[model samples]
Target: MDIIDENFSQDFHCLVYDNAPTHLKRTPTAPSAKKMTKNTPPVGKNWLVEVNMYDENGKQIYNSDGSYKKQHVQMSSSGFTEDGTPQSFYFEPGHEREGVFKGMAIILEERGFKGCVGRNGRLAECGDFSQGCVTAGQPDCCCRRMLYNEPDFVNVWPRLEEVANARGFAVLFLPKFHCELNFIEQCWGYAKRVYRTFPLTKKEDEMEKNIITALDSVPLETMRRCDVLDSRFRSL
Candidate 1:
């Protein structure tokens, strides 16, 4: 009846990476959409979910020379694969990430909690208003379903605690602003580097497939390179 009863230490449960779109070609010089609507990301249903993404205006994807989009993506989250598995989490993003973030109240109704949030909590890759933001301007998308859109963790974190309480979990949030410590950051970097190795068409679908293939090319190698586990990198 435990989500993850692993001991807390340098390594707790499996590393859960945040999710984000890689190398999205957004630009300012490109002809702008009069009013581009935000694509609604799906809502997750799993007990735990980590996301990496931002609501960058699709039109703002170019620079003067078009070399790079100046947007400062945190580059600290993972994305989904073809089969829907996250870079980690050993579960599907739809069921786990959006589901938990929005369904925490429902989940907690079944489980009981045990620890202060943001302290002694389970492992999770945290995202901010970066890619997961759902402002009043956006429509009803499950990814941003933070239960009431309270606009602050204080207003929303308690519901998560309730879910943990229901499930007898101790929500141990990573340290404030401690993305580097989470192994998932390494995974995002891994996926990006792997995707770049290919022709890597800038289109989302093609590039995402390239990434997933790269991820599948060598699971053990990727895991080692990302340091998902404690082991030396094996040579091919």
Candidate 2:
């Protein structure tokens, strides 16, 4: 971001990344119904999402033994409803179970989706949680499925995008399993080929030097050609 501001301040920038798991990961507290209970908890109990604790500096907190310190926090709001009212995952203040998770059934009920949990309604989830509804085109087959397909739920942005948008930049994730569309992969392949030609060395320092030299050996022309090929593929 600093480099972009320093060199290309006048132009809009949108960083493109491949659909790697790390790149697609959302913040731990991001709104999600994957683990939410079907109904509200028992009296004196509450449901919360477990997330890694972070210090004031935004760094993850760790225990003395190096394990991450975990804390339970309410998931963020599930975005606004069609009427533009903010939808919170937990019940509002002054309610019987104030601040407790509303559960999938209640959450859906507020969205005007009724009969999602009782005998006449769908189950908490279909037989295959991953496959969702028993048949395609049956989004209301289950409570969880209904919530999963909700517009707000489906449109939750990844953490990377949130960070980039905060800095006045946009982010786009390339299609998954399409290496030909990501020119950087070709650059890495070129670097590996160059590395293979260097003298074999088991020493850590020499290996590091060879790797740096290999990466630097990728020509500007080769990078441009790879990018052009990717652009052509995208157009197709």
All candidates: TM-score: 0.28, 0.85
> Going through the candidates in order, what is the number of backbone clashes in each?
36, 0
TM-score for candidate 1, please give it: 0.28
**What does candidate 2 score on TM?**
0.85
The CA lDDT at 9 in model 1 is 35
The residue pairs found clashing in candidate 2 are: none
Q: What lDDT tens digits, residue by residue, belong to model 1 across residues 1-236? A: 24354444333333232222221222222212112111212443222222222346634444579554443211111333334433321223565443222222221122232221333332121233345533434322222233223222112233344455465554434444556555556667676777677973769988778877876655566655555342222111
Leading candidate by TM-score? 2
lDDT of 2 by residue, 1-236 (tens): 88998999899997879998999999878867788888888888899988898899999999999999999888887666546688888889999888998888878877788786556666887886686566645778788888888877788899999999999998878999999899999999999999999989899999999999999999999999998899789778
True-structure lDDT of candidate 1:
0.37
- The total number of steric clashes, by the backbone 3 Å criterion, in model 2 comes to 0
